[model samples]
Target: MNKLRLIEMIFFLFCSLLSASQKPNILFIIADDLKASVLGTYGDKVCKTPNIDKLAEQSLVFDRAYCQGVVCGPSRTSFMHSRYRGSMGTNLAEHFKNNGWYTARVGKIYHMRVPYDIINGTDGQDIASSWTERFNSSGREAHTPGDYECLNLNIFTDKLEHRESTKMPNRMFVSVSYEGDGSDQPDYKSASKTIALLNEHKDKPFFIATGLVRPHYPNVAPEQYFTPYPWEKIKLPTIPENDLSDIPNLGKSKIMNTNNSIGKYIDNQKKMWSAYYATVQFMDEQVGRILDELERLGLKENTAIVFLSDHGYHLGEHGFWQKENLHEEVTRVPLMVYLPGIKAGRTSSITELVDIYPSLTELLGIETPQEVQGKSFLPLFEQKNKTIRTEALSLLTNGKGYSIRTKDNTYMRYKDNSEELYDMNKDPKQFNNLAKNPEYSQLLKNLRSQLDLRLKQEAVTIPQKIKKVMIYT
Candidate 1:
């Protein structure tokens, strides 16, 4: 070969070697109850999320990612364990620790109280036993009074920390909030601990779960975070009065009336919004800090970062305060993956968070646990803008409810066997319920049958022999 051709070949080989030697670092950043559209990249007219916007610009954003459940605890259990609701059984906590991963957690990775949630306090109960190392940063709520308080359930009639306690709309009032060195807040502390862990474990491949507990509820933030957005500039979510008319009484009751700010529907909407935005901004800053540390320590090229929310929240949309509805606002969360070799600035409207576990395993070219219920999105990464799941299912408990969200339609099925279908493209807000319309009855029936067939396939129990083998592994 000539000298010029040899030089070109050598350069090409060098570039390939550079890429092959570096394993992508994972910076999985999750926001609590965050909506995708609330960020500037998602076209939020009023909100400013420069860090998230930058991340989104350089990453793949899933526009149609839906959670298995809307609640925090169970939603997280399924996400972290990489199992669908039916497949998770009740032992999600044990499955992680038993599996081969150096699972260290700093913040609310699974389901626990804010401070206690980061640690292991499920208010005398326990979080999922999924971590090889757990750190507790409890007791940040007392720093600022009247923000949100962690009420001791001992003063109440029941332990009240179980899923049953969250059956009603007012259940949010039970938890408390904290304030302080803002930097020393439990969530912040969790981030700080994560930086230290990353520094300590730079040599080994580890799974570090960091959960941020801001913008979830009790919207507590230090005064500094509140400066950018004045109360007067904040805009309230638009909701028509008749928004609840189409929804059944049972569905309406299950959703909280979140139009009011703070407790008892505070009249000052602007003040409440300021608090919420401040909390989100604070959380974003925390995310930036961790990312900075990851780069500073030269761990960015070796780790893989996956960021998501357990579920989305309703910031006064449709008069709802929290998740637990089939509405788009409550169902859509901010999900982004920053893998170094994967193409950047790509977005897909794929369905289901269950797909994340399989996707990660495929990206790393490793075998996923036998218990995983998700399919990997590696195909989409290779073939841009591809569909992962034909339909994503969301379940609402205590009411025998289920929803199937496809590319064009959303069908909600209730316990009484009544069904509602919406054309999401035309009626994005889901203001129209076509289930009862004679013209669409056949469509509804067809969707219901599809749901049933899918459920039956998912419901089949795993063989005990496999379980035994998995247990010993």
Candidate 2:
């Protein structure tokens, strides 16, 4: 070989060695019911999410990511298995376990309580034979365990049959507000368990899941978290009396229910907002604790970090308290992805969440499952702010509403076939609905067609054929 060619060959091999030695670590952090606009970087104005904000600055932030379903169990289950809504069939735990991933959850990953749900060291909600090891921590208290109300307020109450302010159903041992150490309690437990797992498998690869239960309902956090924004300094959302007039009958029925009196008085909006921010602050601190360990152990470069929430929460918006309604505030979430070899410090308008399955596999150069419905967002990561998805879809079975959000338009389809369309560009708050406007009939038709395409593309799980046994000759 020529001398010049030899030198070029040596340099090529050197570059290959460097690339081969670097493999990113993965740290997936998900908040319970966080909204996109609540973070400091997302123009939250008051709520502080410094840890997540830092990640957002150095990672790819998805401005349009959404969950498969608005409810907790179904939404989380779909994302956990990376399967589309129709494909999950209420068996996400089983599907993920069938895959070759070693899954272990510390807290409320599968919509169940701690030690109570982890009876005999295993919760039946968890895939029976999937996890190599599992740990359940029910914390220290039960829901309304004998009626203790130190931070109870009228505005933050839910009208459900619970004795406490929130409406979540309570069981004998597993109830709301399980006692232990509050934020410091479960946050540390989850972080410590994850750290131990990372240390044990530093040389090998493993898939570990840690679930944090804060900023959900019963938004109880340390008093110190409230120091940043005093009640006087905080600004509550405006409640327009005519907000419902433009909405369709079906939309109004879904948003305003007889039992949703928790947010009746708009005057108490400040207290609810304060509780949300405090919970966010507490959740942020917990996130910092976990990330601190990852940084100290030098896992950031090799591991891919994905931070997301199940869905957004409404803080006195359209007279709603929790998710299950179709609104930007209740449907949008903050999603940040940090993969060392991939892209960093970028922003993508592409829809995220439930798409994690195909996206992660694509980033790692692997083939996606046959039944997965989410498209690979790797292309969008490479091209920041470019349109990966023309429109986004969110579904709710109880409300029978399928919401579609685009860059400039927001449309909702009700079970009764009534529609509510909002030109988000003109009204980001979504105070006005334009579905009845005859002028935009063409635009509505286009959006409806797009929804049809998505629905058909992701409708149901394709049945698998069973193999027959061959007889011996």
Please report, in order, the local distance difference test score of every candidate based on alpha carbons: 0.62, 0.62
| TM-score against truth, every candidate | 0.80, 0.81
Distance (Å) between predicted and true CA of 78, model 1? Answer: 1.2
Error of 1 at 193 (Å): 0.7
The TM-score leader among the candidates is 2
Residue-wise C-alpha lDDT for candidate 1, range 90-181, written one tens digit per residue: 23324433444466766666565543333343422235465668665553342243234222221222222331122233334332223345
lDDT of 2 by residue, 57-126 (tens): 7777887787767766656756766654533332333333444444556665655433234223335255
- Show model 1 residue runs off by greater than 4 Å: 1-25, 86-101, 114-129, 142-181, 253-255, 258-266, 459-473
Instruction: Assess the local accuracy of residue 7 in candidate 2 as a C-alpha lDDT between 0 and 100.
Output: 32
Each prediction's RMSD to truth: 7.6, 7.9
Candidate 2: what lDDT? Answer: 0.62
The per-residue C-alpha lDDT of model 1 at residue 394 equals: 77
